[model samples]
Target: MPCRPSFSSGFDGTSDQDAAMEAADPRGSESDGTWEELRLLKPREVRHLIWEQVPLVDASSSQEYLRHHLPGALHLPHGARLQQLRNVLPDLSQPLILYSNAQNRAAALARRLSNLDYANVYVLGGGIGILLALQDA
Candidate 1:
């Protein structure tokens, strides 16, 4: 898919210090005490691991997800119930990665997944936007 020229990246003008701090503390502004075990991955890192067949879940809004997402990504918007996610993902122990328009949203959901007993959960650090950028580059 062609990159959307006007895509809303959802990135506020935070300083590099702020971004670093957020990375250091995954909970950051969306702290809910459930992300301590969740892993964060860069776009290139994900690309390298594609051969492992890790499932990618798009936690972005349905509209944005449909517009552009990694190949083979499954949609599971952040607002969906944990039960809904569980239904789509039957194997709780399977390793999976989730991404959204921004890090916070996917991180939040990754936390939920971790809390839901999905033992191997990860989030794309800068969300689908960064992955898209990596592909375009």
Candidate 2:
């Protein structure tokens, strides 16, 4: 039988855990007190954009994030403070791409980032599932 990966809520020295902890913000992307029309990108475009080294922020739950995420993606939990995000992504003008299992979380993060004056914040339309499906195909 093939060996199954063990799951742990605590960090266990794995790359995924490292990535999750590196980008974790317990406060999450809460209401920025403003809303804006989110810029949406198709999965194909996002896939290509990854080659350019644009940071992909996964706004999914930690459990979902541990299960899977895009290569080099950062995990951003809900309710994280804007200041925390600034620490992770210092450049306000840099383009940021966010995704989640459901579009709501990603959209919320995008709005928060945009309200914080992130020059280019976009949400992955249809979420990570679509992107992963495209990858599989």
Candidate 3:
């Protein structure tokens, strides 16, 4: 008789493949307010906002930003560059949108911007993924 593989060697309930599947599943998308928490908007919404001249700031690294970014997004990596931002954005009351690949970083940047007395600062809830998705749709 041939020996059978152990259950652990098989699915075991938790595996990289399983994790990927879970992430891809839309079921979890509703539970977390990630889509709404960051006040995510569709590309059309963003475009409308842009036409309104709302300031859009990309918090991703320079290289990541170079690859692709919103039409009028300005790169402003979080931390150590608050002063530089002040120079370009003199009015703190200006509407600002902050985004990164992940919400954690964008949230951190939003907090920093707020602490610096910049009013009307918002973090794009789902970052670039949601924006791209909307555009694709």
Candidate 4:
């Protein structure tokens, strides 16, 4: 007789209970290569982080940034003087969250920061609209 696959078996051959346990746990990837602990936070969480003094860098253009932005967010428009970044943000180790109206600009700035050896850099998902909504809420 041929052996048959069990209903509880996952792609990696782990049982459903094992996968569930891994998903419930928070540490790192399980057999599926999915992050166990990572989660996309809401705008309120971003706001709370900002209020807690986390450094935020707005990668939008000067006009856009000046029009409206998080009260204390540092404006570092992409392709501006990189030296300005060094001057304004002397501590490269700080938790820096970069954001813009869209993902391209923010991702570009994040890449630049990463190349410049910023250790704790992150890009905000959903951008300013999310933050605005959170504020409205």
Q: Rate the local accuracy (lDDT) of all candidates.
A: 0.69, 0.70, 0.62, 0.61
User: How do the residues 1-137 of candidate 4 rate in per-residue lDDT, one tens digit apiece?
Assistant: 32211222122323333344334333343565332212323344555566567877788988888887776777889787767887988788888777787534776777777778877776665566555643343
How do these models rank on lDDT, best leading?
A: 2, 1, 3, 4
Which scores greater on TM-score, model 2 or model 3? 2
Candidate 1 lDDT over 16-135, as tens digits, reads 433543465555555664555668876555654554677778888888877877777778886787887688779999888888887777887887887778998888776666656543
Candidate 2 residue pairs in backbone clash? 27-79, 27-80, 28-78, 28-79, 28-80, 29-79, 29-80
Instruction: Give per-residue CA lDDT, model 2, range 4-29, as digits (tens).
Output: 22222342233432234224322234
Better of 1 and 4 by TM-score: 1
Q: Looking at candidate 4, what is the lDDT of residue 129?
A: 58
Better of 1 and 3 by TM-score: 1
Model 4's alpha-carbon lDDT is 0.61
Q: For candidate 3, write residues 65-120 as lDDT tens digits.
A: 88877766778875657888889999999988787775457677877887888888
**Top candidate, metric TM-score:** 2
Superposed on all Cα atoms, model 2 deviates from the true structure by an RMSD in Å of: 12.7
Misplaced by over 4 Å in model 3 are 1-45
Q: Is candidate 3 or candidate 4 better by TM-score?
A: 4
